[model samples]
Target: MATTSDPNQKTPLEIREIQELAIAISAKNINPTMLSQEFLKQTGIVPNEWELGKQPVLGPNLSQVTFQNGVSIVAQPRNITFMESIGTKNPSELNIPNIARQYVDKLSNAEYQGLSISPKSLIPFPGSENGARNYITRTLLSPGPWQDYGKAPVQAGLNLLYQLDRCQFSLSINEAKIQMPDQSSIPALLFAGNFNYNVGSNSPQEILEQLKKGIDDWSSDLKDFQEIVNQRFLAQQQESLFPGA
Candidate 1:
C-alpha cells in the first residue's frame, strides 16, 4: 500500500485528529510540561511570560503561521472543563477558545453549540509512530525532578486521557495503510479498515479474526464517524470560504 504524498488528495488528514489520537495512545503516562510543550509546539507557540494570579505563566504564540515544514499551526478556543488561561499573551496567542458555558447562550447564529473551546491546533499529528513515540518520551520527564513550579502531571494525564478518548487508534495513510473512503472502493475501505472501529487492542491476527465476527457493526461505525467528520469539516470549510451576515 503506497501512501499518497498529495496534500490535495480526496481524503484530507487533520492535525487535530493526530493530536487527539496521540493523547489516547499515551493516556497512562505523560509529562505535563512536555505534554503541554509539545501540544504548544504543535500549535506553533513561542514561549512568553504571562502573569497568572500571583505568579506568571510562560506561554507561546498560538498564531496561524506556517513552519519550515509547511504546516499551519493555530489556536482554537473551546469551553474548558476546568481550566483557565494566563490572560496576557502575545498578539499571536490572543485567539484563545471561548471555554465557558455561560457564553453559549450569547453565541451568534453560526457558532458551535454546547461547549466553548480554547485550543491550540498546531502541527498535524506527526504520524502514528512519532506521535506514539512522543508520548513515550515525554512520560519520562516527571515533575518530581522539579519541585514547587513543577508541571501538573495529573493534568497531563487527564488531558492525555481526554485526547485518547476522542482519538481513533488506527494509523494514517502512511503506517497502517488506511485508504481514503471517497478515494477507494467500498471493498478496499472495508478490507483496510476491517476492525478499526471495532475490537479491543490485540494482535493483528486477533483483530482481523474479530472483524470476521464483528465486521457489520464496525463498518457501520467507521462509515458513520467518517461521514460525520467529513460533513463537519466541509461545513467548516464552506464557512471559512464565505462569510455571511
Candidate 2:
C-alpha cells in the first residue's frame, strides 16, 4: 500500500504544517539534567552552587533556553517517547502507503544501504523489530536495543511517537537515583520548564513524587494504546496473511 499523500492532494506547505502541529503537541517538558543542577544551586546542597546548565550546551535535547534563578523549574522531557495509537488500535491499518512507505524505508535505510551499516540487512528479519532497530540506526531515532524499554524518556518517547506514528503524551518525573556519566551518581528529578542555569530551585523531591504517579498513568495509557494496535494490526492482516478466518 502507498504511504504518501497524493502528490496533487495536500500542498507541500499544508503537509509541513500538520507535521509541525504533531511535533508541537508531542514536545514534552522534561529535562532531568537541568533539574539536577538547579536543585544543587538554589537550596545550596553545597555552600558553592554548581555550574549546571549555566551555559547549557550540554545534556540530552541540548536546550536552547537559558534558565535562571527567577525561572520556573517545572516538569520537562527527559524520557524517551513511544507511540500510543490514539484512535485506531490496529497498527497495519495505519501503515504508510507504499509511496510514503518508501520514505519510511528510504528515510530509514537509505543511509545504510551503502554505508558501513550496509550490512544492516544481514541482521535478519529486516521487517520486524529488526526493521525498527535498523531504521532507527541509520534513519530516525537513535538505534539501540530493539524493543528496549530501558532507555531514558527521550529515546523511548521518540520510539513511541516517530516509529509508531502515534500521538503521545509525556510527563516528566523524578528518578530514584541515576548515576551520571562521571559515575558519581546523584539523586535527581525530571521536569519540563525554564530554570536557573546555575542557581535555582528545582523540585527533585516533588518530581520523584510526581513521577511515581504520572509515569505510571502514562505507561498504562500507552499499554491501552498498544492493545488497540495489536488488535487492529491483526485485523488488517487477517484477510491476506491469515485468510479463511
lDDT of each: 0.26, 0.25
Taking all chains together, each candidate's TM-score versus the true structure is 0.19, 0.21
lDDT at residue 140 of model 1 (Cα atoms) = 27
Misplaced by over 4 Å in model 1 are 1-3, 6-210, 231-234, 239-245
Candidate 2 Cα misplacement greater than 4 A, ranges? 1-210, 239-245
lDDT of 2 at 22: 8
Error of 1 at 211 (Å): 3.6
lDDT of 2 by residue, 1-245 (tens): 00112132232122110010000111133444453444434434212432333454335554332233212122235321111111222323321122122222222211111000000000111113223223323344455555456554222222122222222333222121222333332221121111001101225444333322332233333344334433632234333222233
Best by TM-score: 2
Q: Residues 1-245, candidate 1, lDDT per residue (tens digit)?
A: 22323223343332122111000111112222232323443434322232122322223322222222222232323211213222223323322221111212222221222211222111222233233223323432344533335564222211111122423433122112223445541101111111122233655455434323332232233444344334632233332222231
